[model samples]
Target: MRKWTGGMLILALATVLFLSYNFIGKEPHKQTAYDFFHPSNTSLAMGSSSHAKSQQRIREKPHLIDVQGLDDLYLSLNMSEEESRSLLVWAQMRPLLSRSDALPDTVEGIKEAATAWKELLSVVSDTRNISDDDPGWKDCPHTVTSFNGNLSSNGNILHIPCGLIEDSSITVIGIPDAKQGSFQIQLQSSQVLGEAIPNVILNYAVHLPGDNVTDEPAVIQNTWSNDLGWGKEEICPDHRSNHSIKVDGFVKCNALVIRSSTEVNVNVSHPVNHQSTNNISVGSGHMSVNFPFVEGNAFTATLWAGVEGFHMTVNGRHETSFAYREKFEPWMVNDVKLEGGLQLMSALAKGLPYSGYLTSVLDIEHLKAPPVLKKRILMFIGVFSTGNNFERRMALRRSWMQYDAVRSGNVAVRFFIGLHKNLQVNLELWKEAQAFGDIQLMPFVDYYSLLSLKTISICIMGTKILSAKYVMKTDDDAFVRIDVIISNLKGMVPDGLLYGLISFESSPQRENDNKWYISSEEWAHDSYPPWAHGPGYIISRDIAKFIVQGHQQRDLQFFKLEDVAVGIWVEQFKKQGRKVQYISDEKFYNAGCETNYTLAHYQNPRMVLCLWETLQKEHEPNCCE
Candidate 1:
C-alpha cells in the first residue's frame, strides 16, 4: 500500500467502491412487473412489491408495460407493479380505448385495459366484430344504425364493422347535440375493393322534424367525395403514362371534386368541377366517390363539415374544396351516411368508434408526426422521399447519416415522404416515422409527376415549421458529406440565394409523352432559365420562405418538373430586382463519390456505404471546433 503506483491505487479504489455498492445496495427482493419484463440490476429484494398474481395481470396486457424508461427508477416504496401498469394503461385509454371512467387497482380496470388493447389489435386486420359488452358501444349518439333492410336478416343494425358486405348499405351515424357548424369524421380503411374506388360517397344529413318515412328537406345533404381522382396506371397499363391519373366525379354547383391544383395542364391538374378546369372535379354523375381505398393501406381521411360545404384532407394536405349544395342549417347537420357502395376499415367520430361501437383499426394518432425540430438547429438536409422508397431512405440512415454532427443536433437530417394511395406503404411509413422520428409525412398523394410540389412542400416546412436556417433538398438516393457541408455553410453569407451545379439555357422538354415532358400550353416560355438540377440543391431560409410564400395554388405556375419550377422562381425574383444569386459549386456532383465533394446524388445503397468510408478518410477538421 505504501508503494502503490497509479494502476495499484486505481485497483484499490475500484475494489472499495464495488464492495460499497454491493453491501450498501442490500435490499430484499420484491415483486415488480417491470422486472418481470426487464429484470432490474440495482439488487433489490426478490419479493419487494412483486406479486405473482399481479404480474399475471400485466402479462395479459403486454402493450401497457411498454412505457419506456420505467426501469430507471426502483419501485417507489410499496408501489406495486399491478398498480403502476394499471395506471399507465388507464391514462392512455382515456383517449385511446373506451371513454368510460375506468377505476384503477380493481380487477375490472385491468380487464378493460386488456380488452381495449385486444380489440384494437384484433380489428386492425379485420374490423368484423366489436365487443357488445361495453355498454357505451351501442349507446353513443354518433353510432351508426342500419336501416332500409340493408342487413335485416341478421339484425336491423349493421355489425359494428358493417360486415364484408358486397353492396353499400343505407347506414346512418347519429351525431348528438350536433348544432355546430364544424364537425369532423375520421375515416380509416384497411380494405377497399378495387371495384368500389369510383363510387364511394359520404353524404351528410341533419335530423329534421317529420321523418315517418317521407318528408323531404329533412336531411341537409353535404355531399363529400363525388367524382374524385384515381390512378390511370392501373387502367392504362403503360409505364410512361403510369403517372397518368383520372378524376371521375359529379358536381352541379358545390359537387365534390378532388384534383391537383398546382401542376398546370389537363393531363396534370385533372380538376373536374371547379374554376380551374385544370384544378377541380367535372362531369355529370349520380354516385360520388370519396376515399381512394387501397387493398391493404390504413389511411386517415379527415372530413370537416363547414358552413360553405365540407373541407377534407386525406392525410394532412388540402384534398379538395366542396361547396354546399343543400340549403339546410350547417350546424344542425349531424348524420353522415356511407352511400355509393363504400367499404371501410373504420369510421370514428371524435376518434371514438362510430359504427355502432365497431373496433378501431388502430389509433389514428400513432401516425401523427413527431416533434423533430429543436430551437437551435443550424442546418437541415431534407431528403425527399415517397412512401415506396424504403431502401434508399434506410441506406442514408446507416451511412454518413450516423455522424456526431447530426447526433449532436448541429445538422438536422430528415426525410420527407408523401402518402401513397397504397395502404400497405402508408402503414409501413407510419411505423417508420414512429421508429426514426426523422420522417415528415405530407398527406399529399405521391405521384411521380408531382415532384416539384413535394420540393416546395419541404421548403415551406423547413423555413416555416422547422425554423431551419439552411436547407439542402435532395433525393432519397443522394448523400451529403455532413462534415464538409457543415464547414461550407459556416462561412457563407446565408440569404436570398440558391446553390448547386447550375444549368443555363437548358431547353424545356416539349415531348408530349415523357416524364419530364412539358406542353406549350403548360409553359409558354421557350427555354427554362438557369436552374439547379433536381438531384440536389441548397437554399437559405429566406430563399425557401420566398419560394413557398409566393407560390400558392399554381401561383408561380408550378410545372411537374420540380427543378425547372425552382429555376422559374429564381428568374422571377431576379426580374423583380430582388437578389437571386446562384452559387455554382462543382463539388455538389450529381453522381457517385469524389475525393473532395460537398454532396453526391443518385448513388445506390452500397455505393453510399463506400462513399461514407472515403469521406471519413479525407481529413477535414470540424470547423466549429
Candidate 2:
C-alpha cells in the first residue's frame, strides 16, 4: 500500500505541474453556453424520456473532456497508475453513472461519467467579460461628534453618519402634547439609495393617560423592517411580570414609573378598589411611583447603546432596556426620529462613531491581493448573496475573511451571486466582481426560487475547481470561525460528513401564506430529511463530489430549499452503503448571534464588523457586543 501511495503521489505531482502550466498559468477559463445546465423544473415529476433526451443532448457535446485530467484525479485520490487506467477503462464502458459510490460496470457508463465530469469542469468562471481592475473606493468618515436641534412639525431628525458604537448616547427633551394621546421616538436605519423606506431599528412609543379615567399610560418598544413589518413588542412594565395579579375581582396591573432622582420601579395596583394595600414595590423600597411622561409636561430621556441592547433612562432613572433584535444592530441606527404628539425642545447625540477606522480595522493593503487559492484549500466557502449586497460582501471581506486560515489559503471564500434585473445594479455588481477576485457570478438571474442553482455551483467549485477537502455553504450575513470549524472537522469522519445545526424532525411548510411554503407538488414527503439550517453547514469532499456528479448527470432532484436539497442528496449517499456522520452542534446559531458561536447568522453588515472586532480584541469566540 505504501509503494502504491508513493507512486500515486509522484504521478499526482507530475500531473499537477502539467495542468498548472496549461490551465492555472493562463487566463481564467471563460464559461461557455454549454458550461451551465439549468434544470427545466425543480420537481422530479418529469418523464424518463425527457430526462434521457436531456442527458443525450448534453453528452453529444463532449469536446471539453480531458481524459488525462481523469487520470490525474484518480491519482490524486491515492490510486496507482495501473488502477487509475483500469478505472478509466471501466468508466468508459459503464452504462451510466447514477450514484456517488456506484462505479461503472461497462465502458459506456465510464464514458458517460467522464463526459458529465468534463462538462462540470467546463464551468470555471463567470462568462460575462469583466476586467480585474480596482474600482476606486473612498472613505466616508463621520466628523460630526454632536448635534443639537429643536423639534419641528416633522419631529426633528438627527442623522448619525457613522452610526452608534458602544456607550453612544442620544438625549431628548420633549413635552407630550396635551391634545395628543401618544408620541413616538425612533432609532431608524438610513434609507438606502434604492430603498423606498428606512428600517426602524427601535420604535419607542408612549401612550398617555388622557381624558379617559380608565386608561393608564403605557410604553411599548419594537423593531420594524421594510420587508417584514413590526416584530414582537417588549412593553415597559412587562405584562409577563404581572403574573402576581389575577383578574377575578380586583384586577391588579403593573405600570412603569420613573422619578427624577430615585430608582425606577413597576407599581402594581388594583384599579377597581384604588387600594394602596395592593400596591407592590418593584424598586428598593415600597413607595408610590409615577409615570415619567405627563401631558404638556416636559421630560428628559436618554437612550444609550449598551452591549446587550439599548437602554433608556428617563429623568436620570433607568426605565427600560430593549435587547437587540436579529438583523437590528445598534450600529445600523443612523437616524434618531421623533414623531407623533411630542413638542421637542432639543436633541443631542454624543459618543457616536466618527469614522470607519473606529469600527472596522480593515487592512486595505491586504485587500489588494487577498490570500486565496495558492494551494489546495481545506474548505471552500460559498456565501449566498444578492447583486445589491455590496456592503454585506465588503463587511465579510473585512471581517472573518481576514482570518489567518483564510488569508493563508487554507480556506477559500467566494460570494455566489446571481445577476440582477436592474441594469445599474448589474453594472455595480460587475465592477465589484472585477475589483474583488472572490465573487463567483452565476449565469441566471437572482431569485429566491433559483437559490438551489447557487448551491450546485458551490459544489462544482469546491469539487471540480478548488478541490477542497470540505465544502461549506453559508450566507454573506453570517460570521464563520474558520479555525474553529477546521478543528471540529478534524475529530469527525472525513467522508459523508454533514455538520451544522441540524434539524432532525422538521415538516414542510404547507401553508400558502408563508414564504417557505412547500407545496405537495414540489415535495411529496411529509417530513423533510434531517438537514442543517440554511445559514451555514459543511459537507465532506466525497458528498460534494457526489452532488456535483449527480447534478451533472441530471439524477439529483432539485429542491427550492438548497439546504434541504443537500440533505436529500446526503441521505441518498448514506443509502449507498456509506457511513454518514451527522454532527449537530448548537454553536452554529441559525437565528442570531451568541457567545462562542461556530457561525452566527442573520447579522447585518455592522454586526459582522463588530463580531470580527470583538473576536480580535478578546481572542475568544464572542459575539458582537
Tens-place lDDT per residue, model 2, 99-156, is: 2222112122233224433332232133332222323322323333333334444556
User: What lDDT is obtained when candidate 1 is compared to the true structure?
Assistant: 0.45
The runs of at least 3 residues in candidate 1 whose Cα sits more than 4 Å from the true structure, single-residue gaps closed, are 1-376, 552-555, 617-625
Query: Candidate 1 residues 88-117, lDDT tens each?
Result: 212212121121211111222233224323
Best by lDDT: 2
Model 1: lDDT of residue 494: 83
**Per-prediction tally of clashes:** 26, 15
User: Which portions of model 2 show Cα errors greater than 4 Å?
Assistant: 1-150, 159-173, 186-204, 211-214, 220-292, 295-336, 345-363, 367-376, 383-405, 415-465, 474-494, 501-528, 533-536, 545-569, 572-579, 584-625
The CA lDDT at 281 in model 1 is 24
